[model samples]
Target chain A: MLMMGAVGLAIARIRDLFAVSMLSGIFSLIGAAAYVVLDAVDVAFTEAAVGAGISTVLMLGTLALTTRKEKLGGGKSKSTTAFLVVAVTGAVLVYGTFDMPRYGDKIAAIHHHVVPRYIEKSGEEVGMPNIVTSVLASYRSFDTLGEVFVIFTAATGVLAILGRARRRREDEEADEGGSDTKGAAS
Target chain B: MMHRKVVLRVVSKFLIPPILLFALYVQFHGDFGPGGGFQAGVIFGSGFILYAILFGVETVKRVLPPWSTRLLLVVGVLTYGLTGVAGLILGGNYLDYNVLAHDPLHGQHYGILIVELGVGITVAASMITIFNVFAGQSGGD
Candidate 1:
């Protein structure tokens, strides 16, 4: 929670894209660690790698093509409105938390049902100790396929961005050559 | 050329290979432990990140040419998608591992391995390529 607060502060205050990227990566890693502590290793692993590694690189790459520093002290002020909204949201969240389960209650609703079946039978059937692996690769393989699609989509986006610039450069080069030819002909 | 940071330079040289190897182990050993293709990919990607951080993006690019990165990225996606298609052709459902080999267990093993490999390759290349793009844009600016 403290780290989360620090991350929010850093994201809000930092201006340098690289610094912001590093901080956000830190924030993501922390989230992964939090997930691990919650006994969700698979989710933690995904969160750590995708959130911290790839996302940071993508955001930084985009920032590199654009402005590193945002216009400070020139944007319109929304402090009062933002504060009121935040206050209301915080109050609601806190209210909701009062009805939530206590940490690490073994009999929690989440611990019931088919998960136990997976945990018990996965090793014998799949010969894999990690039930998460069996679940991800065998049972929920389609979801993993979807995840691959998501990655491909992101890569395509990056290629499109880079490709646009290359095309623009080629157009400019063609224009320059056309003018040179016209000059020679004239 | 700027004077290099002694610690980061030496550390990266020794650290990058081990990190990559570890990533492979994680990918392969995922069936037994707490890792898989995605985690392994990031760990492998981190090797390139270390390389880029220590030696500049130019050196990293030279080592891993952009065309190869793009190729690997495509190949990874193809590898994953094709494994599923292969399963389908074998008369099972899409990405059904039971159809991969004569024996269902063996088929599952083969299918999982190939799919994970594809994932790892895509992950590592995409990560490095993303870094390269940013570095290029930043340098140009």
Candidate 2:
């Protein structure tokens, strides 16, 4: 948790977008480690892969297309209100967590829910040893389908935006190869 | 360029295959492990992303063009939707795996496997597509 705070602080203070992105990735990786400590391995796996690996690469790609540093003193900043809002929200969130059940509280409200049924019957019903997989893929398959559709939609949106920009660039420059795209790394 | 990138290129080449192999293992073995389509897809996608970063976008694009990645993403979504439809056609409720096989237990297994596979396909394709498009642009927006 302290490591996460350190990374977040570093990211907040950094004016270089590249370093900020790197710090954010480190923050995510630490968060993933916390998930593992909490025994939420599946979530940890997703967090590490998506947050650390994929997000870092995507951020670098975005940086490749944009300026490396944050522009200072852009317009009249509303620092006071922003600070107030952030403080209030953070206070509220921290206060809310205080009321949550302690880790693995035996008689926690969440423990009394359908989790028991999922644990006991998932093996026989779904015939899977990993209850999380059976729960996610079979008992609640519709939800997974919805998640997939969401990703599909997001990709479509990105494609639509990029396609137009590429076309406009081509029209202006009429460069067939667009070889400049590979010029940096190569 | 090649001289400067020789170590990066050689190391990634050696690492990429195993990375992809682990992703497939996660995708197929989720029922017994702590990973699934979501995790596996990102891992798989990152392997390619690593290759693209070190080897240049053009080399990766030659194998996985933007248009094909788009089609793969669409196909992934369809596979999941159609699996649900299959459950309906088999006289069960939508997404009901009881009718997928003779044995209801095995049916659930098959249903989960195929559904996760659908998720894996779409997710991996989407990641690749987004990365290629974003990095493929020649200049800043």
Candidate 3:
């Protein structure tokens, strides 16, 4: 927990974009560690890859194209409404946690019913030891498909942005030489 | 930028392959472990992101062209969608492995392999695509 707070502070305080990105990666790894400690190995793996790995690259890439330092002095005043809303939401969540299930409680709804069957029989049924895998690939295959599409959509969006820019660059270069040569020849 | 260190480059060269290999392992070993398509995809994507980080976007683009990545994105979706479609044609519900082959176990093996491959491809490409957008932004320093 201390490490997580420290990582958050490092991210907020660092002026360098690269350093900020690396710090965010550290924050993500911390989250992954938390998930692992919670016994959610699948979630831990996802957080490690997405949070620490891909997210860092994406953020750094954005930094490469933009200013590293934030605009120091030009932003509008903070909105009190936004602050109050966020505070209220956080408080509500904290309050709601009083009703939450304690960790490792055998009576928790999440640990019982069809899930337990999957956990116990996945090894024999799916011929695999990973209950998470069996549940995701076999019991909830549709969600897996949806996730793949989500990635596909994101990839397409990026390609469209880059493609438009490349085309503009080519057009500019073509006109640059043509206009100069025509002016000279004429 | 030129004055910046090349430490990322050397590190990426070594890190990218292992990251990818680990992704593959997670994908295939999931049935016997605690991972599957989503985890594998993210791990695979991270490897490409590492390449982008170390070598820079230009080098990463050269290695995996935007067009190829786009193709992969489409292919991954198609592979998964088609597997489900195959099950439907075989007189079963969507993604039902029982109809994929004479033996249910054999069909499951085939289905899992195909779906995991799809997940890996989509993940690797999407991650790189996100990185491309970030790198394409207007200011590095």
Candidate 4:
């Protein structure tokens, strides 16, 4: 956790987008390790795969197509307002955590609610050893279904925008795409 | 230039199959483990993305054409929605697994497996398609 926090700080302070992206991947790997410590292996698996693996590759792919260094701003910065907003939001969020149950508190409301029924009866009812899968697939599947469509919708949006990019690339290829590809390859 | 890098090509060739196989294992074995469709899908999609990185996008396009990714995306959703419809047609509530088999227990098993597979398919297709969109254009947009 401390390493993750240090990586986060480095990412925030870095001006180079390429280095920042790399640090974020490191941060995610550390976060995945933390999740494993917390016994959320499924979440850890996801964080490690999506954050450390695919997103890092995609970010590098993007960096290949763009400037590595961030362009310095010429206008006056809004540091005061941004700092104030961050401080206020951070304080309020910390305050909000005060009312929450202590970590792993047995008396937590969530443990009292539908959890017991799932824990006690899920084996007999669903006949599955992995309650998480049973919950995600069979019990609250409507919710998971919605989540899948949400991903599908996001993909649709990306395709629509990038398809235009492809067309523009094709048109440019008619002119000087050869030179561009040659430059990138070398 | 990338083709000259023989180590990347050889290593990725060695690694890709195992990664893809692990994704399938995660998808099917989630009923007894700490993995499920989402994680499995990302792993599987990244397998191809790794191929693209090592071999380039054109090679990957030959393997997974754009139309096929789009079709897979739709087919995933269709499989999921149709599973629910199957339950309803079998005289249960929407997404209810009780009527899917001879007993409710086995029904839940089949229901979970099928639905997780649907999620896996859609997610894998979505990730691959999205990555291709971002990486396909060599020229910056």
Question: In DockQ terms, which candidate is top?
Answer: 2
Question: Which residue runs of candidate 1 sit more than 4 Å off their true CA positions?
Answer: A14-18, A45-65, A74-77, A97-100, A173-186, B139-141
Global lDDT for candidate 1? 0.82
DockQ of each: 0.56, 0.75, 0.55, 0.71
Rank by DockQ (best first)? 2, 4, 1, 3
TM-score of each: 0.85, 0.92, 0.83, 0.92
Q: Return the TM-score for candidate 1, rounded to 2 decimals.
A: 0.85
Model 2 regions lying over 4 Å from their true place:
A74-77, A172-186, B139-141
Model 1 over residues B1-141: C-alpha lDDT tens digits? 237588778767888889889998999998887888888988888788877866788888888998998999999989999999999999999989888888888888888888888888888788777777667656654
What TM-score, to 2 decimals, does candidate 2 have?
0.92
Quote the positional error of residue B119 for candidate 2 in Å: 0.5
For model 4, the local distance difference test gives: 0.89
Isolated chain A TM-score, each model: 0.80, 0.86, 0.83, 0.86
Task: Please report, in order, the local distance difference test score of every candidate based on alpha carbons.
Answer: 0.82, 0.89, 0.76, 0.89
lDDT of 4 by residue, A1-186 (tens): 888778988986788999989998998999999999998888899999999998898888788877799877634457667778999999999999999999989898888879898889999999889888888898899999899999899889989887776787678887697788888999
Per-model clash counts, in order, read 0, 0, 13, 0
Q: Which stretches of candidate 3 lie over 4 Å from their true place?
A: A9-18, A73-81, A169-186, B1-16, B52-63, B132-141
Tens digit per residue, CA lDDT, model 3, A89-175:
999999998998986778988767798788777666666566666666666789989877877876777767875676687788889
lDDT score, candidate 4, position A148: 91
Q: Interface RMSD for every prediction, one decimal?
A: 2.1, 1.3, 2.5, 1.4
